[model samples]
Target: MLITNQLGQVLVQHVDYRDTCLLPGGAADKGESPAHSAGRELREELGVTVPLDRCLAVDWVSPDSVSVPAATRFPGEILHVFDGGTWDDARISDIRLPRSEITAIDFAEPAQLPDLLSPPDARRALSALRARLNSAGTVVLENGCPLAPGVLDRIGVLQTDRPSYRYPWHPGPAPHDRTVTQVWGWLFAPDGRVMVLLEPDTAVDILPGGTPEEQDQGDPVATLRRETAEEAAARFTNPLLLGHVTDPASRRGYLRYAAALTEVGPAQPDPATGHTYTRILATPEQAAELFDWGPATAHQLSAVHQARRQLGLPRAARLPVTELTDPITC
Candidate 1:
């Protein structure tokens, strides 16, 4: 058992057992809060009555992880993580490490901690917490130990204030409509160019898209096909499936599917409904330059572009973050 401060550094006790390694305070009396018990135990065992602030975690030796007495009922050790404490290395010299049972004490730096002992989730929280301390004005956010989702690419980047597919910031049960669906399309024109429509209110130039009908199937491929026929009055021969992206609106809760197609000719107005479209033909090179395919979309295009280029195949488009071989671009 090891107690770590808010910075994730272990508080070591110098004991007879070699005195270099540190161990956390063990067990708790009945009706004692984990944080309070740790403070009391420190006072009783070593006379260091350091006031604790928060119970960061409970380190219980799982039955599978360690050996423990079956009869003893304990919460193991509580990691009372804290900042603004007055205790220093000099005062610890007078403290007592009881010889009757447990022995020794010493402080351990964070880098020495094994990854196995500190889970990824725990390490992420600890890392973020430590980074905040280097900047005194930072707000230390409690990570709450979120579980990593199983599918897809590892989350290498982080956006603190960005929207999620679900309400990550406001986490709790809430009413949501399942009927709303996302519709996206790839409308190609005659001269190896594609139609890109800019949203009237926004600066984004994306493919024409709309919401799906209530009774329409939730499949994105079907929805994109429908939007193409209805909104642009264009026919697509073969629409290849691309990877999906989580909607930025709700992050974890919403999803959007992507697909591409090649066609020849301009989009026309729907004769049956008198519906017209706002469409313009643009080359893929122009698209890569004019439109930010979005970081999520950029990652997808990068992967696809890399694969095709490596195999020496004809590429459909250049990626937005494509490496520049020239000195000026870099």
Candidate 2:
């Protein structure tokens, strides 16, 4: 049998079982069980031994005179089915094929299974296995190839489960005023560019600033300098706090600020300490289209920067906010 992964990629195998294509297994030896015989036959036939984990079925073939049942191999023979270890081998070797009895060995999606067996048995031998593969993040391709990096989609569990994203917040009376820890000066070039960072499946498009820690001996401006160098690896020659938004219920708000500074050096990719992304710059519209941004932030950016012309501002500095968390490098 040419075993394959959830994906339809075929691995090394012996025969296609003379076109019958049910999982190949023979009769048991003197004292060994049917399943034991199956395990042995699997190894001998495919040259790759699999430790049987569970018995899948015991198909007892018979000749029903009432209505001729579907033709089956091992007629009057007991078909013992078993599941085994994962098929991880990429190639098959030392294969001994009997061409006169078996022509080829190939893996395929269940929809392309042979038409010899009864529908139910075929489902057990193929369809059910395909479903299991899909749930295991094993995609069976048309060319009998199984894609690697096995991962089951969350949607499978969600089919019978419901979940939601939530922000854990304290449930208490709203405070009168929240403390402002740090104010960051975000500087952007004039070419409608901005800095952003990314990680898999999650993104954050924000300025290079944070709140002052208790250990910090200086003010919020000093904190911004420290955070910028620490997080973005860029030195700030000039930073100015612009405005402040206070929310009593919220833990803290920012003293929003902006300034003009040179991004004179290479913007290193996120060191991946946390989910990190490099700085990016684009027009409001371009930023939204190029990267995944939250609706509120995208709208604000779009309103402020219109094709690089902010009506009357003599020298304003702003950049697009974006983040990429995909695993592959951009």
- TM-scores for the candidates: 0.32, 0.34
Off by over 4 Å in 2: 1-177, 181-184, 267-276, 284-330
The lDDT, on a scale of 0 to 1, for candidate 1 is 0.40
| Residue-by-residue lDDT tens digits, candidate 2, 64-146 | 41134455433455545455534533434444554444454555433344354344345335422433332332233221212
lDDT of 2 at 195: 39
The per-model lDDT (C-alpha) reads 0.40, 0.42
Worst 10 residues of 2 by lDDT: 156-165
Tens-digit lDDT track of model 1 for 216-292: 56555566666666655545544443334443455422223323343323545544445544444444444433332
Off by over 4 Å in 1: 1-180, 186-193, 199-204, 252-275, 288-294, 303-330
Q: How far is candidate 2 from the true structure (C-alpha RMSD, Å)?
A: 20.8
Compared with the true structure, model 1 gives a TM-score of 0.32
